[model samples]
Target: MRKPIAPRTIRGRLLCPRVDTRTVDHLADGLVEIDEQGVIAAVGPAPAGCAVPETVPGTVWLPGFVDTHVHYPQLRVAGRSSGELLTWLERTVFAEESRFADKNYATDVAADLCRRFIASGTTTASIYGSSHPIATAVLFAALDRTGLRAQVGMTLMDRDAPPDLCLEADAALVACEALIARWHGHDDDRLRFCVTPRFALSCTPRLLEGAGRLADRHDLPIQTHLSENPGEIAAVAARFPEAAHYLDVYARHGLCTERSLFGHCIHLSEPEWGALHAAGAAVAHCPDSNFFLGSGVMPLRDTLTRGVRVGLGSDVGAGRTFSMRHIAASAYDASLLRGARVGPEELLWLATAGGANALGLGDRIGHLAPGYDADLVAVQVQVSDPADTAELLDALLFSHATEPVRNVLVRGRRAV
Candidate 1:
């Protein structure tokens, strides 16, 4: 077990997503008292009977970013591309993922992935492991030691994949069940198990249905890809001819629930958007990946107008950077490309609170309010004027692509 953080109070300049509004709350000079259990005990001006606080200058305290979608096995594949989605996956992605079948390789990569996440200021993430169950187990063990919060799953694919990477349906389900028994809700629910079907094109109906049953039996969240590319959408339509659209394929199998997180809704029609809204499912809008692979921009306004929950994803390998700031900047550009305007507050919310809310972790990790986990990132930023929070944030998102994340704390224990 990881060592516990000692309870203490911190005083700094705070900028965080407000619980009830779309904007951020700027406590220019504020105090946050953390209890022994690493939960926030107070927020605002210093409480009565407090000691002289330790202060850090030129630093801004914000909620550690929550990355809703990332592929653990693809960390090394980040800048490599094959022009588009399906072809890219076949040529580069699949070949790279096949390396995870080696347990030693998986362990080394898992440790490196956790280190990069911490360095990039991502506190919580929903991760996709390769189809190897032992490799997936290695990932969980690595995360357990690193102290990052995550929901990890073994990618389930029974067809349309390399033979060594695909598992039979029965064996896949058994592996998932065993993984859930061992890792789900482990470490005070900081480490979780997500049932992942690679996507409709790669998974047969039997495999998708069995994956849904496992998610339902464990009441776990489900993560998978959706209409990411035009070619991919057409292939799903050809594969599931009985379904109305791509989203309907998983909906028919009971996978479209509030806990379902569908990555890349970039090619959806009106009816498909309606289905997602009706199902109360969330979307991980991977603008960076879309831009990198020449996939069309996601219609951010239409999806939000339809009342579907949405968050940003780095989608690394396909996504160019691990920084949530880069994701937010890309999302801002994608929104403008679609003729919609997105403010920095909204983009920051997507990176932090919106992601937590989408993943059903809203009440615990998103904000710095009382009773919330003390997961925070301290970034070194110089603010000459206190009222320039908006301008400061704008520069941070668009200009400071490689800003140093000075410290990262999960449950008040420093991780980086």
Candidate 2:
């Protein structure tokens, strides 16, 4: 028989999957010690010769998911638009984003976005903010209140976008530098800055180059869309005729790096994939949005074989939900379209550790282990079968927000 632990205690089937993102150890009862710094000190079977304190029944604790791609400004437009990618961006996204020009509107929506992220059990996200500095400030302020970890950036575009969203290349770079100074490592490095150029279409070569330089100066993470739709691809090809391909545009500007995170690399060529892998850049595989928009399914297996890092993304607005679990299950479906199926363990890995690694934050968060932030969520289910762990995991991924996440913790404090 296992002995009891004396310190702060909670009893339930503890599923502490290792950092390797492999098998889970099912501790029928476990103890998790939260250090004073709000980090996980230790997790193990109840220590003998001690008393168990509080027990949470019928719940499993898992590392909170890291969403590598999402748009904070897109929350207002999330499920209302339907059309091709570029069309939706113009008719729905552009108009709604213009509202960010209003400071009050941006503040309210910023709070709303944070609330929605917490509601969906996403403890960390890489977010794209609108072009307005005040709007981005409002977004950051709202996120600061949530105790969540995130990397957010002002959307930088100097051409081919709504007039309200455009800024001169120098001005955009200056604003980016200021934001990095203020929030890049705020809240003990929980909130960070990302160097974001909305996409190739929205940024000229001059702007992309400036953004890349700012990223290098601040050493910030870079994010952008790439080859999401065929039309979008053709347009980029025509726009940058001097470049060999769409990815080459960014490459030429020195935007491709290990810290770069590209969203929806659906239409990448063999050369593009090779360059991405060589540069150690990662892809945020946004499955739901791709399926919803009829964007081509990302070739996950092919990318994996080519040795590129891939993570799940909600791609909100374009994606119907903010839940990374939904992203994980959607990825499974996407895999099936290619005559392959993603196993449950692999999907969980993609949602947590894999995603964290993709964002270049592997060691900081994304596992129930020592030296990692205590960002976690509790999922409970009553089942008669022993395989309920797998069932519960599957249910978490496939169910459309029906499964209750009983509690959420970020940095050892309750978030929900």
Candidate 3:
């Protein structure tokens, strides 16, 4: 097998903030030295003996942003918000997702989504594919061709979704196991498996239990939805009468572990927060989707104070944008609406390192530090109105397509 090589010279005005949970730092006029194989060798001042490449100015370099949660099959249906979460799913999402059964269609949209993500400065994402294994495989193939680092999983729903989207419980588990065996840890671990169950309402106890078993056996990360909206919660409550709450359904099935990533945790209860913190599971705070669907704002401050791990998600389709910049901006607005404010540093951390941590990839991706993958982005700063550099960073927290992401590198190679 051929090995990947790093760039001879990666010249730019680097803007990496230390995204560690312990402390954060922002560096300007920085330069990153990449080794032969696409990984960061050094970051900061160019060494004395090194041949310096011509500098590229007027662009801010950042570690490629990580999106903790997104649905690949729903990429084409962005901004289709007519009603709340459940209604939107039935009226638009499920119907559009069902089209992934066509392999050609799946391949085309997968490539489109990958391009959109790169254009927005995101280098990695955890994505959910359609239930069809062939469709999921096509999505993976598209990502492989596109050069984005991703954990892509086939969506498993035994019930409640559209008839074409649903799968039999045992059959779905078998397919998931086969996929893991084939794709987990592929491409030097750039591509991975995420055992995905659509959600509690779409899955029966048998399916969730089987999925948990498969995940344990393969040691794969798990992804699913939680208490996203009142209607969805009510539907879950109605379906699982024996469970205490929405989280309880996953908890009882052993799906609430540190490796599990629950998306759209907007309307969670106090006990659910406690359980999530105790379980060491991560939450993907998808503010744009919540706002678009008319769902409640996520309790970001409360979750943080409770010591729960949180990251950002561009819950595309419902989220209306592929950029984590949009998600970060929406997050700040969501926090303000909930009577708490997130500073620029914190918001940047959420989009980069916080997201890496949420996906259990903190040490591997999401930073410009040595030993991390050389996944970086160059963003052109163009403030619409009068704003200083400090305000520019904050503007990224809530603006729409204001700045252009000029370059994207994944694994030391140019991606966009």
Candidate 4:
């Protein structure tokens, strides 16, 4: 991978999600100075005696999106509308993921995935790779080339999967360890390894326990699915009859912790919500995916009121788009269907700062403030009235077509 270029200053209409207020902050005319180390040195009005550069007449600068859940191997299969979750996986997802066993094929797909991420303004994402170690390595290499921050893991499923995608517990653990050594914390910690067990139905007790042990030993984060659909939940209960509930199975295996990110938590119960809050685990709300699969809408109000951390995810393939803005719109619609109203501030927060907090990287990359990583996106704005920031944001979110992103910067270097 090539080294990033020297830092520079950018002046624009700055917009960011603030943690203190849990809202989006807009600065009509602002300057952001990045240091040589790819950190934000200062953010606000231009410094005294500093040379003021020309500003784009109508552009909005905001932190690059943080997509908390996505599947790297399923990129090609995205937008294939089929039956519900389990049937969709059997018909489309499994067949598509099985292609990743070829390293060359995986490499080619990885390039496309990274380019899509840049085009969609996603600077950071937590990715799920197919159950092939070589394929996962190829993905890391591709992401490293683009300087995109990410957490990737080899999908682990020792049972109920096609033989080509299944690995025994011991072999899976060894592969994960090797991946951790080779890629975890690589590239100045921009890349990370996650312990991903494709979810309970596909994993045996031994596999889940082994995954938890490996994660604890390496201090790595864990990602998995939970209660995405009714049939899936019933299958989990049938598979683990002794467990009190679906969450208990993971908790007993030492997988329920602050670093755990469970995706598509649509059918969770009240007690399950409490368990998540108590364990400090986070949820990745893939609303578009839920809508596509006919999965029930998640109760966003209940989850937030219970103090559980929630972030937005593309859940690509299952999710319709790579753009977090589209996901944000879906979230709003999902919330409304559940009798809750989500405003623009909350939606933007879920896409950026909320995702950072969910992935335990809030201080590093979510906000466009001093000391944060300089990951940002510049969007062309054609609003007739530039004075109303809220109106501009609403137009961007609700419109059928969004203006193309003018530029993207990651780690103080221009990425697109």
Q: lDDT by residue for model 3 over 299-415, one digit each (tens)?
A: 897887787778899988788888888888889889999999876778888889888888998888888888888888888775553225566586565555467887788878888
lDDT of 4 by residue, 1-416 (tens): 33556868898788878867678888877899888888898999655665676455567899999899999988998988889999999989998899999989999999999999999889999999879999999999999888899999999998888899899999999999999999999978899999999999989999999999999999999999999999999999999999889999999999999899999889888788889888899999999999998988999877877778888999999998999999999999998999988877788888899999899998898898998989998887677777687787786677678778777888888763
Model 3 spans with C-alpha error above 4 angstroms: 22-24, 46-51, 383-389, 399-401
Per-residue lDDT, model 3, residue 416, is 41
- Which ranking of candidates, highest TM-score first? 4, 1, 3, 2
| Lowest lDDT 10-residue stretch of candidate 1 | 46-55
**Candidate 4 residue-wise lDDT at 406:** 76
Error of 1 at 230 (Å): 0.5
lDDT of each: 0.88, 0.82, 0.83, 0.89
Q: What shift in Å separates residue 68 of candidate 1 from its native position after superposition? A: 0.6
Candidate 4: deviation at residue 72, Å?
0.9
Candidate 2 lDDT by residue in tens digits, 1-416: 11122323344556666675445556666777767677778888876764865355666777887888998888879886569898888888988888999999999998888877777778889999989888998888888887778899899888878788899999888888888888888978888999999999999889999988888887889999999999999999999999999999998888999999999999899889888999999999999999888899898878776778888899989998888878888899999997777776778877887788888988878787778777887776555663556766666667654566777778877663
* Candidate 1 backbone collisions, by pair: none
Clashes of 4: 0
Per-prediction tally of clashes: 0, 0, 4, 0
| Candidates sorted on lDDT, descending | 4, 1, 3, 2
